[model samples]
Target: MTVEALLIWLIVGAVAGWLAGQIVKGHGFGLAGNIVVGIVGAFLAGWLLPGLGLGLSGIVGSIIYAALGAIILLLLIGLIKRA
Candidate 1:
């Protein structure tokens, strides 16, 4: 990826990961975990949202969607652990 793309991804990942942690009511993971979540969540979000006819555009949009996805995954994991 270009430097610009990488920078954008970093920014998006930071915001999205923190937001995901907040949504799931869990302590935010360290920077590395956040990066993993944010990047993976971006793809997950892109896959899932389309089923509902929702979409994200640009870095901000993608980050928002990705964050939501990461939150869902975190929440699900919490539920599974509690069971």
Candidate 2:
């Protein structure tokens, strides 16, 4: 992808990660960590949502989609840690 696309992905990932951290609570992984989480979450959502017949569009949709994925990711991590 181009630099612009990469930058957009990073920004979306950061925002999604922050939102997920806030929603999930006690799962904040700082900026870099959040970006990673968000990007992974986006991928997770991209894979899962379409299968579920759910698809989001536009920047806001992207953020929401990624945030949802990030939330799930954090929850799984929490569960794994507890176990």
Candidate 3:
């Protein structure tokens, strides 16, 4: 991917991660960690959503999808940590 695409991904990841952290509560992972979480969340959503017959469009949609995935990721992490 081009630099522009990479930048967009990072931006999306940051925003999505922040959103997920807020939604999940007490899960702020800082900037870099948030970006990683968001990117992975985006990938997770990209894989899971399609199979579930959900489709989102545009940058906002991407953020929402990624945030959903990030929330799931955070919840799973929380469970793992508790176990």
Candidate 4:
């Protein structure tokens, strides 16, 4: 991917991660952790969303998708930890 694309992905990831942390409550993993969560969430969304017929266009949509995926990821992690 081009540097510009990579940069955009990182930005989107950061934003999504931060938002997810806020929504999930007590799940904020600082900056680097948040970035990781965001990136992974994006990948998860990339796979899961399309299968569900969810299509998001542009930056805002991407952020929303990533945040939703991150929230799901956090919830799953919480469940695993509790189990």
| For every candidate, C-alpha RMSD to the true structure in Å | 1.5, 1.2, 1.1, 1.2
For model 2, the stretches where C-alpha displacement exceeds 4 angstroms are none
Candidate 2 lDDT at 48 equals 82
lDDT of 4 at 1: 100
Write candidate 2's Cα lDDT for 1-83 as tens digits.
99999999999999999999988985577999889999999999998888988888999999999998999898899899999
Of the pair 2 and 4, which is ahead by TM-score? 2
User: What global local distance difference test value does model 3 have?
Assistant: 0.92
Whole-structure CA lDDT of model 1: 0.82
Ranking by lDDT: 3, 2, 4, 1
lDDT of each: 0.82, 0.92, 0.92, 0.88
In candidate 3, the residue pairs with backbone N, CA or C atoms under 3 Å apart (3 or more residues apart, or in different chains) clash, namely none
lDDT of 4 by residue, 1-83 (tens): 99999999888889889988988875577888788889889888888889999999999999999988998898899899999
TM-score leaderboard ranking: 3, 2, 4, 1
lDDT of 3 at 21: 92
> What lDDT score is found at residue 31 in candidate 3?
95
TM-score head-to-head 3 vs 4, winner: 3
Clashes of each: 0, 0, 0, 0
**Candidate 4, poorest ten consecutive residues by summed lDDT:** 25-34
Give stretches of model 4 more than 4 Å off: none
Any idea how many clashes model 3 has? 0
